[model samples]
Target: MKHSITMLEKTALAICIFIALIAAAQPELMTEHIQPVVQDILSFLGSGFFLFVNFLLFAVIILSFSPLGGRKIGGEHAKIEYSNFGWFAMLFAAGMGSGLVFWGVAEPALHFMNPPLKQSLYPDRLASSLALTLVNWGAHAWALYAVFGLVLGGLTQYSGNSGDICAPVMSAFGNKLSLRKKRGVVFTIKLIAVFAVFFGVVGTIANSTLLISKGVEIELGITSPLLIGTVIVSVLFVTYTLSAKLGLRRGVQSLSIFNVLLAFSLLIWLLFIVPVAPIMKIALDGTGYYLQLLATGTWQFDSQLNTSTWATHWTYNYYFWWLAWGPFVGVFLANISQGRKVWQFILAVVGIPTCVTIIWFSVFSGAAIEWDKLNQAGILSAIKHDYTQGLFVFFSQLGWQGTILIWSSLLLLLVFVATSADSAILVIRQLVQNQFKNESTLYVWCLALFMCSFALLLQQDEPLNRSIAILGALPFLAVFILQLAGFLKEFVRDLCA
Candidate 1:
């Protein structure tokens, strides 16, 4: 089977190769020259990005109840490929699995000590911390993914191709724009989205590898072995690649369900063993505060606080990460989510996962905070020294300390990271390919992405990684605005019909 190359794919691959070469050769140059300037620009516009995410949260809500929501995503003849549980599990696994486990405890812990909303009169740091975690991982972030998914939901029925965000944008306005201009613009935007996803996945793998290595070091007698990390990465790449080869229904779905079960077991365990009344109090108070001030709090920007680092690093960085991931997650969800109405797809993609997110943090982070406050175990203090071991520290404090429990959690996390990587590689393969049947395309991206992740693990430069990611994120945020405009125009026209 011969694969044909197009101008868009060729250009994108060339740019990636060029950047990779330079980054591999001169990591210091990027941190010194490029990162500072990009960081400043993103910090300045951080508040606007926050507000934009909030807007998406409500936009999904409003659109759901509108006439457009009554519309169907596919024709009457469309067929459902996966059951609702299977669909939600697979998409949720792809969308958040690894990162959620990493951040579930760490994010709220970090925010409790060093909060972005420092001057706000919110008493009880515990409640505020959980609320902020919910704010970050809540509806707004998922809604961004849904917006992109909704735009491309109909492509499978109409185009018989892998669902890509560019297809929908081009369909909506291709007739009005010149051929050269439309291709150039759409291709450039997609290239950015692709790179964003590539960096996000690579960074995630590198970070998770470190976390797993730390867990191994803490549990056993070994101390910071590179061989262990390398072995783990090799195993991960091979496992996820094989899983991807099994395809979605069998490989991805099976792993997705396993991880969800694993995570729920831990959550349920924590619910029983941890201080139940206090955690419940944290959940209710935090969620109440978040709901009350969702809109205004998101829009507020106080430069007077002199906590630019907090805003830029925490809130701003999260929004960029979420936006960078939006295109891949959105298209991947849309691909599996045929044979459903527009409203059902939107709610499944956006609403349900969000509810799970709140519950997740309530169990993990909420329990961590309570332990730190009452027991004074200094688990929070220890994390400041080595962030990689944050989860292990939380695990030690968990009421169950059996060898089986500890090892099981670690294995669950390993599978979770693999699921995320394979899902991402599949998304990137579909984005760049012309034929959906070609397994070779999937093989190429899967190996290449694993290689890239290894290279990044060697360099270990946060700024360069973040700078490349922000370059993709900032532009895609702009592109997202354009997509919203195009989608609304077409949606209104359909309403009139």
Candidate 2:
């Protein structure tokens, strides 16, 4: 037991160090490379893949109402059920909370200002711009979450095991190795999964830290902002980790509930105080354009005429960003999702919330566009200059009351960032220790915090994007291999059966 514990500690340390080094080396590469590949794969997989998978699982659920996939395997029914509240809460948390909050307003406005290729889709560039935003957020974004959640959740439930979430890929790669002789295969797969998850969690931590810090700096005029922000975030994380260690149902669930309420309040304020009708009109128009584009433009990866620019800026960047998020968020979602059918899981976790996100995008994005239209402030240009300033520009449009609302919303954004970071730290601890119990793992949490701080510090003088890009790229090839193996195995097993 002593030797085993020592080995585990050493392994955890090694993993942390390795991730820190990668983060320090080139942070943007992951978003540049691996993400685009994942997107391409999903484009090929199509949204129907998730819909069909859910339908098949729903049939199975109707037949069994148990954990059995037609008696090939069987277990107890899930303790969790799909409800509107549960669905929305989980979606808000898992969908990168700040992205929705920050981008909800920013993304549509950005698109409206700079329409993507093929402006002819809309009557004018503004309509086309809104449409582009909706397409990216509504279709591509949700499709990823749905596909990953379906596959990960289905496999986890079916196996009735709590091994690393990447185990299903191993099962997919069956016969490629002699499992009897190659125990190292499992270890390697787990290591890769853990590493991929680590990189993702680190990126999330850095992003959240930056956002929260900026929010604080803006709201309070806090000088030495990074120091103040870091200290505050550290305190919050320490408090959360303590609670999480107590238990998931108690600390984690309570925090999640609080986060939801805070975020909801912000949304309500935006919906009511902001011009609702115009936003809805913009959103509807955006959704239409997005859908039309989704049918035709999702797979446009032209390699010849500077496709890299587009891929780097939009497609690949978004793909990598989401991929960077996948393992940590995927594992978190998988853990909470129990006693649920695949179809229900997909709908609740991925489908419905994504629809809600569209509404969010419309409100926030529409508000920004309205501000730009009314004020002629070039909100998009300000965001490009400094994304943080965009919030101030937005607040200015709301007038004096808008200032208060924006401040409150900024606080909410800080909370979202804090909640996301806390959850990520917990998930990383679980990954490092190979356990999911809600126990305080201060060593891992502190180590994660340190690594994030180090990454942030390093970024003061250097570009971290390349490092992120490289670490990010490393996982896609493995995921692709696993995905291919999974498809082949499914085909073969069905044929043989």
Candidate 3:
């Protein structure tokens, strides 16, 4: 109830600064040491990651349809805080916006040209490619976030004590963990969550800068890293900073609505330009292939699959990326999801967002595939040179309107990044203070985030930033396992009570 900063908060601040400074000082060296470690980690935990994610997807689906789904999140009489559109917009924007834009066209094109499985395995490479893209951005990713959000929201709501990510978990498992051991575990988990958020957000900031700078290059032809970083970072910092200050209800919600609208507009415009029939066909075929192959594809690392290298780079990489972002997005989603029924919450969180993502990728990727059939492979060639160019290249095929489309996309990209950034800053601030509605320390957390992200942007090493994020997530896999346990315990207890 009172605003106070704890020692854990101070430690989180200090650690964020320290990591940022080190990353700035030795980006290459850091990447060199970290990449191999993360590579080995991916190999070791690859199958487990797949299994855990699949379990989450199935658990969410089963629970949504079972008797438990009828339970309201806050309480039966609790007031709905945000309108349905507002809530979905905020969650979708915070969780998936930037990454969706960044990879929308590029990933599908890449997979088409270089199918993860042998070409002999799938006759329709375009469908297979789109299916793989759907797998990455689809229900599985949302299921992970939904599970975490449900656990965090349920424990906090039922126990009536919500602080950092660990507080509710501690409340759930209190009797089992000795006080001394509980303190240690809480510290460890909180620390891991903080670091994971730091790396995850920093990676996003860096990648967003890369893509936005690419847009600038296309329009204005300014290519200096310093100028581009300063311009983009300054604009984003000012934007999200103001948004964070305006608080969640006003700023985040407004930006999210704007973002979702703009995104829909772009999707619609693309629909007109791109061939509609082929896009529809691919969407249906891709959805079918994705559902049919979901089980086997979940375990792409099996010895018989013989696609370890491709799977490791594509499927496994996406799982780890989503895992890294799980807690951050989970916290944001849980905060916004009060007063909804369990079934409604999971359905909206996992189902609706994924449906939107499928349509988005189908439009963008289907266009690229159709174009490649006629353009002598120009779009894929540009994308291969720079993945960020995929969106621009795809737009260029729209004739004279290409320039306007390109600028509109750049605006969409920035807004998406801003929404994600502001939400993350708010969550991190709450984690730092272990309390909600405190604005005194908002700028401190924001500055820390900007520093890390700015440092990475300066380095301009997207791979390095990504590797660090994946590494940050490695420790939290243990936390996720514990969260699953805590959630089940809380759910059963709630039913009995």
Candidate 4:
């Protein structure tokens, strides 16, 4: 059994490397072909049916937390405090930090400039442009996370299984078949988890490296910004991985807390120095539009005359991107979420941070948009040039105080990247150990980090994201299907009983 397990691990690793190679070899073709498939799957799954199911699940959770239903679920008997604030902090760092920090200003401005589908809703480039920004960032994107967390957490805790998040999908196979009876099932689960994490880590490392490289290139005339940035990120990832290998209590948790504090400081700075009234107005209008368009915007996939392109670019791309990050983020979330109830996990992981993200994006991105409108500046043009450069340009427009914002933004970006790296490393450790709380888990995490950084360097223009999208899309669909099946099965069983 031990030898077989070793062989299985080796095979999984080989498959990951092979996929990485293929992605590196044919990025454009791979992206063009694979992205459409991901879009179709996400479109199908993210349609009205999926939305209705998610709403039902949310209602169930709300009811489950009430006094009457809480008693039924043994919520009253539960002894833990649930650490609501800690949960929020961790969830914020895990879910939105990397992407928000990178895209908060850039995304809104991009939408404002291009207007994904060139929809006639915002014929005049007024504050309404901010509405579309909030729509993409706020509602459906976070809704998916909420749904995934609720189902995964509920299944793990309620079913009294091993409490591994990935177990639910695996359990969908049932204990009947001979294949399920063998060790192959365990190997397959581990393999899936491994691939998922690899996909997320590589994409993140590459994107973050790209951002940092661009930042350096703008600040200093570094001709080989990509190479330099890759090396720097590789080094930092190695260091963080070593820290992760040192164990969560000592390394991962500490770093996460620090990252949160840094992010908080940045927010505080923005609020105090930046004008707030415009941001508040933008946020309010954006939130209203988001609510109005939530239902209609989700399924607006028009293939003819380029109507679907916006859905393809904003909604579908966002959906697949989130799905790509799901496995690593899900596994990492599952690990930290012990001793907490499913309801608590769902709310903490998905709800609070989402609200916070809405506010954060509004403040940062909205302020930039407002600044541009007031000054009639070319901030939108900078965003058009490069999404990563937009944030710096927005900061620069803030005057002398802008320097402080730039430095703070840079630091915040680093912290966010580090937090993500730490989590990815931890997830990698968990997969390799095949058990939570292993003493040598940190070592395995560091090794995985090294491998991720290596891939980032070797395959700079690799369609690593395409591979991630494909691999993540499969298990994501599987998990969604299993959750639906489980919900239906439980509903029927309750009806009969």
The number of the candidate with the highest TM-score is 3
Considering summed lDDT, which 10 consecutive residues are worst modelled in model 1? Answer: 155-164
lDDT of 4 by residue, 297-338 (tens): 433434211354455445545556666566667655645565
Q: Candidate 4: what lDDT? A: 0.59
C-alpha TM-scores of all predictions: 0.91, 0.79, 0.94, 0.82
lDDT of 2 at 460: 35
Q: Which structure is stronger by TM-score: 2 or 4?
A: 4
lDDT for every model?
0.73, 0.56, 0.80, 0.59
Tens-digit lDDT string for candidate 1 (1-497): 65666565666666666666676687666677767877887778887888777777888899889866865555445678888888888888887777678777787787778765554556667777777777777777788788777776662334323355776566556478898898687777778778878777776777777777778888886875567677778889898999889877788889988888888887787687678887788788888867755756666644423364666766677778777777777778777887777789888878898888888887888887788789887778877776666677777766445355567777877898788777777777667666534566566667666766666666555445555555567777767776666666665555566
Model 1 residue 14 distance off true place after TM-score fit, in angstroms: 3.9
Q: Model 1's lDDT to the true fold?
A: 0.73
Q: Compared to the true structure, candidate 2 yields what TM-score?
A: 0.79
Clashes of each: 0, 24, 0, 1
Number of clashing residue pairs, candidate 4: 1
Candidate 4 weakest lDDT stretch, 10 residues: 67-76
